[model samples]
Target: MSPDRGDRRAVTAGFGALLSRYRTKTWLGGAVVAGLTVSAAMALRLALSPVAHFYYLPVMPAIMTTALLGRRSSVGLAIVLAIIGCELVVRRDSIADTLANAALFIVVAWAVAEACFRLRAALDAAQTMARDMARRELLLDSILTSTPIITLDCDGRTRRVTQGAAALLGVAPNGALNQPFETLLPGFGAAALQAAQRSDGASRTLWRASRRPNGDAALLTVAAHQLPDDADPEHTVLTLTDQSQAEAARRRERELNDRLSSVWRLNSMGEMAATLAHELNQPLSAAAVYLHTGQADLARIGPVAQPTLRTLDLAKAQLLRAGDIIRRMREMISNGSRAFTEERAAQMIRDLEPVVALIGQDTGVVIRIQTDDEDDHVLADRIQLQQALTNLIRNAVDAVIDRDDGQVTVTGRALGAEGYEISVRDNGPGIAEAQMDHIFHPMISTKTGGMGLGLSVTRSIVESHGSALAVSRPQGGGACFTFRLSRPTESEIP
Candidate 1:
């Protein structure tokens, strides 16, 4: 129940509590009022002694009034009034007549008081019983409304649709009532009904492929039973337990395990990269040395070998680039520390083309690199930035890997005068609405057996450089991941 509703009930129950405490009268208090009433009756009797001497007239009225006000007090008041009548209406001719009349009046008044008392008691008992039943009814209604069950009549018509069952079907309470049970669920047929009838009181699972009015499918653990009815018919009570939450929980657990396994796999790859970097650096250094020796030898051979010398110099430059790549890779694998450099966006895209090709080589998907017309230069940790871009592009490639017309595009461009933006997009099915929130979250993946770490690591890399990674589903039908980087400050600029 809502907090507001509970507060309202509490306020309503306490509203008259204080007044009720002061409204009750004690037995001593009732006797005090009765004493005052009898004194007034005595005064009226004396005043009428000279006029008419009618003792029974005032006594009868006092007896009835006391009976109505207080039952126990009324009996006492009646006995006192009878004594007053005896003293006031004494017969001078016969003592026996006066005594007999007084006794008879006492008996009649006592009986009248008791009859009124018994009638009042009966009314009080009935009212208390009604109040208790009403309270129980309210409690029962609250329970039934929230119960996770849908009751049906013997004729297979929906009689009650609980709030829980309505929520599972994505409808309002009473929305499916008075409808045929078979029509509500896809498989509530004769066979299922017969199984339920055989269950007696035990539960039996019934498959019902039910879709909500809004078209969202639901999985439910359905059970039916034939309630032993005292009437001429038996009711097939259908119980529905929503299995959506349980399914989601299992999915999440699996994702977590996959992510953990992925993390271990990533750690293993880093160790391998570190070892490979050491091994490759030795050969690359020797190759660069050989290229330098060749360029010098060609230089000494004069203008005849000018083309050869130029080619050797080019080879040496590429070798130096390779060495730098190995150094940065080792640094990133050991402890992620940024080594900022002035990097042209166009050059970065050019450097990524070969890697992009290799990624799509086996998958047969087309991957393209696009850059802005302007050669925008930004100060960034080139290796880390490239790693983040690589992760996003790989994710995009995976998204489109299954399609025959799969296409992945990586875009690096200037965001503004002082910033640059990099985006990876794929022409594949976009992320589901349910998984949108947790896509960047660690240990969450949509792909079967996916480690779910690429996006998470990419987001960390982008955030480390003071930017937020964002995602969107474009109208053209694909997922796009993007982030921005700041330009170098005036002091850091070349």
Candidate 2:
């Protein structure tokens, strides 16, 4: 092939390659626009041929086309316009002028195309930024609407709540806006509100609020944060979290602990039963020997004096009573089947006083027993009732043992026509507030070396008999534990 033909083919290939770089649709649209622009420029030139020059008019269309379509299409449009201008306006004799005119048009078109490209790039960047901003806004809205926590924006100066504060106050969002924050949530304390307003920088203030709505009490944790410097300085962000469920869970945990402690107490009681049996056996054996010896002497003496016979009978009766007491104690240790009977409240107290006195002797705690009604009668398992009373008395003694005026009082009072209430009160340091809710729980003890099961087990025993055991701080100083036993009616007493 000839070198001139080869160079022409290579140039054509390059031009075709450039055109193919653009989409097919763009190329077609550019072609149509270029043709119309050239036709308009030529017509304008022809009409003004006798008058003046309109050289730069065609460049405007090329620049605009470049911005709308692309650089490649604008180049094609510029080339076509340059050709049309050369033919219609330039003189045939002045070849240099014609060439210079064509070159000027091409250069102007290139400059305009470059400007269009830059302007197009700037616009595309702006569009991308707008889309990103829109996506971020959507994400923020989703979080605000779906989160469980209540969010609010408040004005620092007026303490007025704004966005996201309505859900906590149980009001419409629009209605809550511009309202005083305290009015919306009256549970919040004035001190906390004042502190939140003064908070600055990135620090946060935290406080708690309590409310009772519809007879249900709820606890909320409030957190306040300061907004950025560029934002309104008087604006603060507040968030509230409901803690009612957490408090309930804590109560359940305490109850479970109490049950566990009761189990531990049972285990300990089982271990102590053998020791108790051995201690009681010695007294019973001695009493039996005395009775047998007395009988033999009386028979050998051929009928003793009436006073001596009476003394022997009394001794026999007392021994039998001691044996009964021992058997009852064994039954309590075993925690066997209950046997309920009509029993006088005063007699029950008297029976327990010896044991209580022994317990208080070492600690110098005086135990006083008082009965409001000697006729107060209840149907109860005698041994089990005694054990429950024993536990309470022991706890009361321990509470007051350290005081110089240590005293524990056990009182039995008849309630109107229904039951009898027994209370054990002490003059000692009262229960702590932190331990109040969990005192009956197993393994929760305020005393050193305490297994924390006494109250829990006592409560279990009392509740098994259709009653509840309660503890309270007395008006004067110490703790009081009380329980009630239902009494039989007059018709059922006999």
Candidate 3:
């Protein structure tokens, strides 16, 4: 059952108990008040006056008691009043007048009691309903306090969590105070925590963690959600839902992303194949000429011609190199590309050479590749980053391809004490002044037949890997697209 429903039941039960207690008190109090007031009036009439004067005592107390006390008590009070009136009549020869007065008191008391009974019953019912409502309110409060959720502020401080949080987090009751949310939900890592804290409105994310509660052995799913802002600003609200179903949803999402990423990579390769084929042709042509010349020389002379042998060896080596380049290009287009991990940054760069080659082939634009750092890695999804870099290089090539002296340079180096910076600089018409702001935005392509998602996808990949990408005009001319990947510390590397 939902916590809310459970609380409602508790409230109803509590209200019923309260109503019963109140009704009992009301009934008893009414009876006592009626009895005391009547007895006092009778005593005063009998003790302080002449014998015949007993009939002069007021009948108001009897009537009032019947009115206030309701049917049963009111009726009983009337009987007592009647007996007193009868005694007075018996003591004197005024029996007719006394009996007449006693009968009048009895009739009045019965009527008042009947009216009081109906009114009192209605009041009692109302009181019970009021009690029930109050009980429900209390139950709602309890449910809110006991729910299994939490909210946090930007300062890494706890703002709210359900009363059941202690059980959810395995902390002592009320011990969650001032605790950093990430301490409990390790999956919220620094970036995710920051995103949640700085979010202006509602956002949802599913997280998976193998961390168990302090005193329990079971793994918990911590569903982290961010509340969005409407017109007014408010503190970010983060709720950690249960781990079971949310984790399953997250797993499915990741799998779907993986499949789509694969399709995208293949599509890119297909698009660049024309250029790659051209790039491969140049090297193959050079090796073929050397082979043909060496064969002619060998036929003119014997099997071993000194100069021809050297030339043949050089041609053989070039062919092998050309074959290696072709293989790399083929691998880049291969359907099965999931063997790489984001944990190896250097390997990621190495794996991107073929895509770069393909771009060179497609555009006939000269690309100078240079790298000064090695044995480095970063936490990044390798395939995604590869796609991003390919897109950027493709853009740079496109930017420079139309120029007579078009040139693109791909460079990677360490940014000293911070991260690794990779840049693709081109020497063609730079981004237009009006289009700079939208350069990395999706569907904002500068080229006549370009899809604008390349740069946008590049930025997404860089950011997802906990990095940043930017655009600027290179010092000499054209545009430069630069992205930084934080250098992995020793522990993060091998």
Candidate order by decreasing TM-score: 1, 2, 3
In model 2, where do residues sit more than 4 Å from their true spots? 1-26, 36-52, 71-74, 89-93, 147-165, 185-218, 228-230, 245-266, 288-494
In order, the Cα lDDT scores of the candidates are 0.73, 0.68, 0.64
lDDT of predicted model 2: 0.68
**Candidate 2 residue-wise lDDT, 14-100, digit = tens:** 444444454235666667666665667567667876797666564466445544454566465656665766566655567787777
- Clash totals in order: 0, 3, 8
* Local lDDT at 89 for model 2: 64
Clashing pairs in 3: 201-227, 201-228, 201-229, 202-227, 202-228, 221-243, 275-361, 275-362
lDDT of 3 by residue, 1-494 (tens): 35797677566555545544544235666566556666766666657567455453355556555564444754575567546654754475577966776677667666666776665665556657667777898997797677766666656566665766656566554567667777766556657766654554323564543334544333353444455444112244555555556566888899778658756764776667746865776768776776877677686887657677766765565475556545544554564232323355556666667657766787788887777546455555555676677778888887878887889888878666676778889998898879888777655677788766678767866776667798898779999988887766656553
Off by over 4 Å in 1: 1-124, 162-175, 189-226, 231-247, 275-320, 347-375, 382-486
TM for every model, in the order presented, reads 0.57, 0.55, 0.40
Candidates 1 and 2: which is better by TM-score? 1
Give the Cα-based TM-score of candidate 3 against the true structure. Answer: 0.40
**Candidate 1 displacement at residue 293 in angstroms:** 7.0
The residue-by-residue lDDT of candidate 1 on 1-494, one tens digit each, is: 45797666455444334323332256665565556556666667778878886655566555654554554764585567557654755454677866776677677777776775665555455545556767998998888777777777878888888887787766666668887777767676767777666766333463444676778677776677666675323376777776767777999999888778867877787798899999999999999998888888888889999988876776686688678878977887788766777777667767767667778897888998888857477777776677778788888888899899999988878877758888889999999888889898766788899867778878987887788999999899999998887777778665
